[model samples]
Target: MSELGLPLSEQSLQQAHNGSREEVMRVFDEQHFGRHHAKRSVAQLEEELQKAYKNFILANEYKSSKLCEALYTRCEDKMDQLQVLRLPSMAKFNAGFLLCNRSFEEECVGPSKTIYEQRMKKMLGKSRSLFIKEYNHRLFNWLVAFSLVMVVMGRFVIKFILLEIGAWVLFIFLETYTRMFWSAESLYYNPGWHFIVAIWETLVYSPIIDLDRWAILIGVMLVILVLYWRCYGRRKHGGSWLLPLYRNHEGGSNRWRSD
Candidate 1:
């Protein structure tokens, strides 16, 4: 009730304070039901009364502390009821797997900025700074530019340079995530139908969903491909300039042949 600063909310809370428990509950239910604008609600109202209990505790608190145990009680029962109705996936009110938003521990009450890799998530989404942080590294960018120029000249195999090295970093991250269950308490900890719903929220977005992005990415990929085909920076006799392990040696012309 302290959180309700709005005039309407204050009025509703005041009404609850003055009315009988049953009357207060009826009003609360009416407000919740009307707020949702649900024509026909499928989920059952929770019989365990919370609003009434809150009022009861507050009214009796001045008399004795022993009569009220508000601290031990859950606070989001109304919010939870509204949330169940808002979810649109099922015919009946139910959360699916992977993204059920259910937690073993209680979530925080106040809004907090979400951080990803030391940058604010909202900023990262709105800007290219996170992905292109290395643009200031002149030597690295120069090398990449040189490689792309080589790709344009006629050696197609140069594209593999990044793929092979990138795989090592990707492998390390994947291995770390696979072992994260102990600390993170991943959905992997609970295997059932609901677990599928729990994971969906985490995977809310993917780049492939947008056709414009797909076309732009494909265009860039094609350009990179053609450049690589023209200049892969391979040796005269054939072999990668950077990767020597698979290079042709002793008059062997086969670039892929490793003796």
Candidate 2:
């Protein structure tokens, strides 16, 4: 028996090598349960058995270790044989095979194509969700910072506008430079750039008095939202809808709840 009380004797190793996977697993469970008395689960026992089997194979010189190596070699051979058997038919292959073949692009080609599309869609959805989440967080921080700057420069409207315009120009320059340096695709499809452009255009075209009024309105609304969030929203729902564009995994906007 090994230190973990696993039966690693020559006889037990032979039984494990010759028997089915389940039978060997059952033996491992029995030995582990006998010593530990259900302190470990079946999965834990199986994992431990795998670890012991690996150690046994690594020992290399012992009879039981040789048997363990032989068992692994046999399992690998069986897997290779199964793979070889599957090579003849396209239908027997995996999603990757179907995806790589351009001929399979026709609709209702096979279940593999459908499975591949579903997997790709799921992967893209998760990636888009993560991108949106990060974008929202960055945008929120930017908004708060700009709002604070607006408050500090509120009385001096022209100075604030000049500062903001400069900032926007710098941002655009950096974005363009980075995209060019990396040979990245056009920013036309990017929502963040779209938002930035929309805001910049609004700022550029709007009247000075109108801009000041809008700024004051936004600041007041932000203050009221922050106060409400601190007093009630945080304690109640553990969430905030301060960013309306923010979406949950279900693609639904978070809404303020009434008590």
Candidate 3:
């Protein structure tokens, strides 16, 4: 109360009715009045004054307290602005409000301690359960998203591997046909183990698929794709896995460059 320019919490609560907006603003400014803590204070004041206002009306106070009305309105506006915050932010604001208004709670005690204690327990338990449910909901959403991503990546990887193997199969067929044409009379060129061995050897040495010889090539490509969208294929019409070598058809003073 001293910090708020009033000796008693009740006096501070009624300060606005006495035309002391300056004193209230001064107190807030002096406290640094950050968004979270300020909202917390406003929320506490709103709840307390609402109860007081109800009691005043019940007692047939014909003239409403201007100070209470103004204070309540101020707190209500701040709380409305603070509605953008989620559960965690709201919880933190509530905590700060409780801490800041500890003096008010200590000064004003209702006649029934048992009723107050029961209400406090019920509110705290309900709040705890609500926050726990929110946490679980967020966790479940994240897990579902993660699972979807994993499934997509897994499918892509499997497809890529099968395509690579199919490429190797095609290359073997072409190589065997070419060798038969090159050495038709040779014993090793006949349809036998020698032809299969030759295709295997060619695949091992093939410049196009040299990286494909390793089992972890799929993992390597995934890393590369993530690092550079389109991987190393950021060229006109999108480049190949191995960039195509185009013939130099232009007649000029010979000039060449290497990547």
Candidate 4:
């Protein structure tokens, strides 16, 4: 047995092959749970296992059919043990190995493809959940800050408009940065990132005003209309400021008008 407690060399593997199944299993147990093995970190163990697996594959590439079959079985069994160890990195590595080596005749392509797909799905789900949680937290904080700014400087119309434009630009930059940072592995694309990019392009590059600017313009118009109405009504009527503009003021009585 090598330092890792597994038969990694051709001579060692041949010796293990001659030995009984119980002996082979005993070696596997030692590699997995032996006292000396406990001193090594999980990362060390995984690295060793990965190296040994590659060596085994290379060594058995042109060997006899029977020997290749035997070594392949050992390799598969070792990977299964690694799975039981619950190391996600190793599990992903194993899945990739299986998928990549599906032409080895030891396993069917269907099963390897299925395992790879399952692993990818799980990884995508985890990434998406984390991305959403982080995004919501950041968005909530941003909205709170924006609200406070509006409350504090709402009387300064020009400054408020500039702030709105700045806020929109900053929001887009941060959102794009966040999406790109969270979208893992170039091999797989996140659907959320694509969707966000599509919407952004459509909104920003359109002939009409961008959505954020349009919203700001509409809001400013509404504020102006309300102010005009209040001032005009106050000047036209001598009634109390708190009274409605439609209140009857034909005589000296403050009453509702039918019209």
- What C-alpha lDDT, on a 0 to 100 scale, does residue 104 get in candidate 1? 9
Ranking 1 against 4 by lDDT, winner: 4
Q: Which pairs of residues collide in candidate 3? A: 16-67, 17-67
What TM-score goes with each of the models?
Answer: 0.21, 0.19, 0.24, 0.22
Instruction: Indicate the residue-level lDDT of 256 in model 1.
Output: 78
Predicted candidate 3 versus true structure: per-residue lDDT over 96-166, tens digit per residue: 34542343245323233234445444544554455444543442333334444554443453234444444
lDDT of 1 by residue, 1-61 (tens): 3344222323355565455445645765676656455433313233334554465445433
Report, for every candidate in turn, its global Cα lDDT versus the true structure. 0.36, 0.45, 0.43, 0.46
Best by TM-score: 3
* Candidate 1 wrongly placed segments (more than 4 Å): 1-163, 180-246, 250-259
Off by over 4 Å in 2: 1-112, 152-259
Candidate 4 RMSD to the real structure: 21.0
User: Per-residue lDDT of 48-167 in model 2, one digit per residue for the tens?
Assistant: 667766665444234433443343344334333323421121122222233323222332222133444454455434434544444434443454456456544432422335455555
User: The CA-based lDDT of model 3 is what?
Assistant: 0.43
Could you tell which candidate, 1 or 4, scores higher by TM-score?
4
Which scores greater on lDDT, model 3 or model 4? 4
Name the lDDT value of residue 186 in candidate 2: 44
